[model samples]
Target: MSRTESVDKGHGRIEVRQYRLSTDIDWLRELHPEWKNLGSIVAIDSERLIGDTTT
Candidate 1:
């Protein structure tokens, strides 16, 4: 299942959208070193998140 989530900072700051991946992300490591952290994913679900632009 695919999910989207948003990360919020304080003071109406920049917003971050987060998308949850259902499948194992190990295959993504080759493309994104950040994917290495995929193994730490403990839970995930379908979510959609929206945030403000950072400026």
Candidate 2:
């Protein structure tokens, strides 16, 4: 597993993003063989804050 993150602040707003990756998907490949040569999985998470609101 690996992770990375980024943040940006501008125009009175702040944005944050996170990324994750994993190559331990052998079980997934075994369960679903249709995904040929599947090597890795990735995910992204994000958040934003503007003024007094967060989403």
Candidate 3:
């Protein structure tokens, strides 16, 4: 498990961002050969801090 975080203040809004990923699937390419040489896929999940949200 690994993670990093940051906080940004702008446009009268405060944003706290946390990012995470894994070393849990090193055998990804071996299992899925069709996706040759790909180290990682960018998967992002985002939401509104104060309003509604979506993934």
Candidate 4:
């Protein structure tokens, strides 16, 4: 199990982001031969106070 955390404080607001990854999924390499030595792939967006503000 792996965990990560990030925090940003500015613009009169505070933002925090967290992530978790797991490699317990079986039959991962069989389905995708490109992913060797990799259990899985995960992607996450940004969590911020600014959203479409154009600032």
Candidate 5:
């Protein structure tokens, strides 16, 4: 598993993003053999704050 994060401030807002990746999908491939060439999995999470509100 690997992870990366980034933060940016602009236009009166602060934005944050997190990224994750994994190439350990042997179990998933075994469970779903039909998913040919299955290799890695990725996910991302993001957040933004503007003034006193966050979303």
Candidate 6:
């Protein structure tokens, strides 16, 4: 099954892996140089936003 995840941009940082299929990782990396590491998986929206929180 397809999976989705969100990586919060802490403070001035930027989101991490698991972005939209159209998103370009290289571009994102250039945009946020502060974030040396990828953020944690925030959610998996089963085709859409499921709720307000995730495990």
Q: What is the C-alpha RMSD of each candidate to the true structure, in Å?
A: 8.1, 1.0, 3.6, 4.0, 1.0, 13.0
lDDT of 4 by residue, 1-55 (tens): 5778788888766576777776765677877777777856554445766655422
Write the residue-wise lDDT of candidate 1 on 18-43 in tens digits.
56555565666778886666653434
TM-scores of the candidates in the order shown: 0.28, 0.89, 0.52, 0.49, 0.87, 0.26
Tell me, by TM-score, which candidate is best. Answer: 2
lDDT tens per residue, model 2, 1-54: 999999999999999999999999999999999986999999999999998899
Worst 10 residues of 4 by lDDT: 46-55
TM-score of 5: 0.87
Candidate 2: C-alpha lDDT: 0.96
Candidate 3's TM-score: 0.52
TM-score of 4: 0.49
Name the runs in model 4 displaced over 4 angstroms: 27-38, 41-55
lDDT of 5 by residue, 1-55 (tens): 9999999999999999999999999998999999769889999999999999999
Q: lDDT of all predictions, in order shown?
A: 0.54, 0.96, 0.60, 0.67, 0.96, 0.45
Model 3 Cα lDDT, one tens digit per residue, 1-55: 6677776657555567677766566578779988775756443344335334322
- lDDT digits (tens) for residues 4-26 of candidate 6: 57665454444444533432355
Q: Which ten residues in a row have the lowest lDDT in candidate 3?
A: 46-55
Model 6 ranges with Cα > 4 A deviation: 1-24, 39-43, 47-55
Backbone clash pairs for candidate 3 read: none
lDDT of 4: 0.67
Query: Stretches of candidate 2 above 4 Å error?
Result: none
- Model 4 lDDT, residue 45, Cα: 40
